[model samples]
Target: MRRAPTQKRSRDRVENILKAACELISASGSDTMKMGELAEKAGVSIGSLYQYFPDKASIIHALAERYNEESQHCLDEALADVTTQSGLIAAFDQLIDTYYDLFLAEPVICDIWTGTQADKTLRDMELEVSRANAQSLVRTILRLRDNDGDGATFAARCLLIMYTGEATMRLAISVPASEGREIISSYKRMMGRELSEMLQV
Candidate 1:
């Protein structure tokens, strides 16, 4: 027997609802999103919204998944050939350059990407993405030194913190790209010096 056509329409409507939610979330902060507005933007009924998502958190969770997929693709491409120490450092710098450029290209979307969820479910999803990024970075650091898992992990976390802080700072202060490059270069130099010391120990 064939399934009901209404079922297919229901799924399509859910997808449309989520898409509209993401667009609205990008324009305004996630906290500012309204259900009525989302229904109007998606051309769906509030009842239909309940049929798909229990609350705004579900829609936001879906958006998080969408953001993660896009970010994973970009990061994969950025780190695809980082096999050597120098290549890893170059990739690290290039990753920062590429990521900052991407984020600056869409500040609103970047804000959406940076959005957080208060619930544990949403936090868990983001945590998985964070852990995956840390693991990838740690692997790259390992190529620079062996038998130092603890140091590699520490380096990855430190670099991630530094990179994220610098990106946000540059955005907040509207720092020029040339100056930002210098700042990032200095960070790379410091990281190299730290790694040298770690290796010597």
Candidate 2:
């Protein structure tokens, strides 16, 4: 972004730009979307759009950040009430289902995620976010283990689980709905097994 939106009006303009971009992305794909079209759709001047976001990738990156932030909020909510092993497992199941539904509902997110595969910068951002999320899970697991000594093994396993969960979601959303749902189900089962043993019974 060339300049961060500071005032309320600027922030609203930024939101409008992103909203227009998302609509365009859903209608076509982000690859073919043009800045002029986004500016026109957003009812903002092209200069204003460029002021907030220098290019298409930055706009898409903002969208990715927003989506991830929302997902993180869901994870935080799930974390808040989960103290026991079964609660943790149920939270994981709920989060998986929530994300699956989110991906299904948000076509723009799907397109942006697909673009990340080809963009090294976006891919690295995703990996960094995954590590941060994994640390949250690791901490929760440690609490379950009575705050046992940092649990290096658990830390590594949590990171692997986080990576696998993302991979599973990407794969699950690619197939037909029936098969995609089955794939998610299988992942939930596998994840349950992975998480169950890591915590106290």
Candidate 3:
């Protein structure tokens, strides 16, 4: 027997608080995320905020988790069409395009991730998530190599650093979107040649 269609899970009040906190943080930054303001915006009591997260740091960490999970989902979907180097290149390009699109699509959210201030916990969480993403992209690149051996691991590590560095550079500077696309293309071309050599293709 088929079950009736179920509605999506309604977000809890704590979730609403976290969402409000992130929006406020992105707009004005971590310094502006006052608990009082957050509680007011989330339509919850200060005690309720504490019930979910003892401090702002905990709230930011939860936001980071949500961001990374969403990004991972997009990347996984982008790579699904990959099957060869050319296909991989196309997939990588799509992945990058999707990433930048996401960033521009919501500058506020990107600011939350990219902002630098009294956010030691959020910064650490961001680095940890980014490292995992770099490693995953690298592993996929190595698998698509025309020639490979045990050395693929080293090559994967190198690709991870290069690709991640490129992405970081793009984020750091305020280049026009078109120029940014050119930069990414150049980086990809260079990395492709370099990877081809490393794999001795």
- Top candidate when judged by lDDT against the true structure: 2
Compose the digit string of candidate 3's lDDT tens values, residues 115-191: 53347776566566666665565566556664355555654556465446435544534577778777766766765
Going through the candidates in order, what is the number of backbone clashes in each? 0, 0, 0
- Model 2, span 1-201: residue lDDT tens: 789888998888888898899999999989899999999999988888888889999999999999888877778778876879999999999899989888889899888786778888888878877887788888888888788645788878888888788878788778899998999999899989988888843
TM values, all candidates: 0.66, 0.95, 0.73
RMSD values, in order shown:
5.5, 1.3, 6.2
Candidate 2's displacement at residue 167, Å, is 1.4
Give me the runs in candidate 2 sitting further than 4 Å from their true place: none
TM-score of 3: 0.73
Q: Model 1, stretches more than 4 Å misplaced?
A: 1-11, 113-125, 143-201
On a 0 to 1 TM-score scale, where does candidate 2 land against the true structure?
A: 0.95
When sorted by TM-score, best at the front, the candidate numbers are: 2, 3, 1
Positional deviation of residue 135's Cα in model 3 after best superposition, in angstroms:
3.8
Clash pairs for candidate 1? none
Return the lDDT, model 1, position 140. 50
Clash count for candidate 2 is: 0
lDDT of 1: 0.63
